[model samples]
Target: MCGTCGCGEEGTVSIRKPGEDTGEHTHSHSHAHDHQGHAHEHSHQHKHAHSHAHEGHQQHHESSHGHEHGGNGHHHRHEREIQLEIDVMQKNNLLAERNRGYFEAKQILALNLVSSPGSGKTSLLEKTIKDFKSQKKIYIIEGDQQTMNDADRIEKAGAPVVQVNTGSGCHLDADMINKAVKILEVEDHSLLFIENVGNLVCPSLFNLGEQKRVVIVSTTEGEDKPIKYPNMFQSSDVCIINKTDLLPYLDFDLEKMKEYALRVNHQLEFIEISVKNGEGLNKWYAWLKNLSL
Candidate 1:
């Protein structure tokens, strides 16, 4: 299991291009197997002894002391769990820095787009690709737990794309991008959009070495999403408010959403767009263009 999130078991990730054989790209974990075929995980089992003593002398205590001793063990276990999470994050961050250096050397403008499921992320990408393909060379890395649906759509949209099916993984890690780059071979001085798994919580914790992180929120969802998922808002550089065309028929408050997002991330830049009718898309395109400058 992932030490950071306790997510998918190892060996559950797969990366492939559209129309490729499904069985060719599974990522496997290296684990030893016993005679019974049980996977043996190498882990350190530490037994911690918590002794409550006064001045190095053993204290003879009753039920109250027993409760205190048990509580100490629980707190100690919690600390170990937190430390394990930190170690996992640090390792991922190191890999992310390596990916960042690669992108810098190649002059690749990589953007990681994250949002909840059905938040119009894919629609925004389709619109962006169709409208801006003439001006900028674009490529895509689509992330999902299963299916090549988004990658197929992006390929049809006129860009070379790769699909990363992370089986039970909740977020795309730096190693996945490093592998996808080899297959996609994104061109220099081009934009690479990584459509992360449709998740708000776990994706916020994993950095795929993108130059910018964009969070999409739709009018159909709660306006208080920023406060509910503050880490996502704080980590993202841009907030794209999609489905504005449905605002008149819905009870969504646009200004309040912006206010809440700004409260979480004062540095966040907002662009309101509706992919269905092409409203405010020019502003989104303009933002993309300015990134190259």
Candidate 2:
């Protein structure tokens, strides 16, 4: 009897010796035993042993395919990715070197002014231009995120000015200044002031071929500015504390601010000025005149 087909269920097969009785019970019992043996052999070969090996091999192949996709999938195209990431900063640095050489060739003293938005940098420049109009030929490169307002003010003060709108860049890089320099008539032995975009952080990292870096800090700003933004203070050659006339109206601690600044940069020169009142600008003019000599 076949195990899967259940052929013994229809009828019993009789098998007897020559003189023995042929019993249906004996025949049915023997057929059931043969069916059970067949089932065991079939299960061992196909369902239990073979299925487990096939499943394990399929899992191993899938794991190997996943690993290949995850590791070194871009090995053949790594060179193109590296070329795309070639340093943008290196190009800016080279332009800065060229601008420095150009400044040297023209014999012009350039100053890059850096500060926050309302540090009165433009007001200070206007006052400086007015004070030194007869002493020096002043030229300005105005950098801002938007309009030509600062450049207009400088021009009304009777100085040659060029405005650079950086669109959305946070700071003016050396390449921007190099292009702006060509627009302005920078005579030999003139004072070229580059009013950098009103940002304290990013502007300090860029050198715009300036002989001096001046940072403008106002009395309205807290006295702890020197310590909070130490990089700007440390990079500056001159620190101008603008709006000193407001000292009586505000609770500003001048001595502490100066102390912190000197601690950060021992060689930093400082000037106190109020462009509105025309006070303390003489000292600033004197410093610029000395630079030219």
Number of the top candidate by TM-score?
1
lDDT of 1 by residue, 1-293 (tens): 43323454454677888888763465533333332253122111222233332233223222224443333333222121233435657767888899899999988999999999999888788878899989889999999989999989988888898999887778888888888988898888899999999999989998889999999999999999999999999999999999999999999999999999999999999999899999999999889999966
* Tens digit of per-residue lDDT, candidate 2, span 1-293: 52212443533322111223432212212366677899668644544444345433654444444333334332121112234756656666788889888888888889999999999989888888888878888988887866667877888898888776554456777767776777575799888998998988888877777889999999999999988999999999999999999999999999999999999999999999988897899899889989988
Best prediction by lDDT: 1
Q: Give TM-scores for every candidate, taking all chains together and pairing residue i with residue i.
A: 0.79, 0.70
Every candidate's lDDT = 0.82, 0.76
Among residues 3 or more apart in sequence or in different chains, the pairs in candidate 1 whose N, CA or C atoms overlap within 3 Å are none
lDDT at residue 106 of model 1 (Cα atoms): 89
**Cα error of candidate 2 at position 52, Å:** 50
What is residue 157's positional error in candidate 1, in angstroms?
1.0
Give, for candidate 2, the lowest lDDT window spanning 10 residues: 73-82
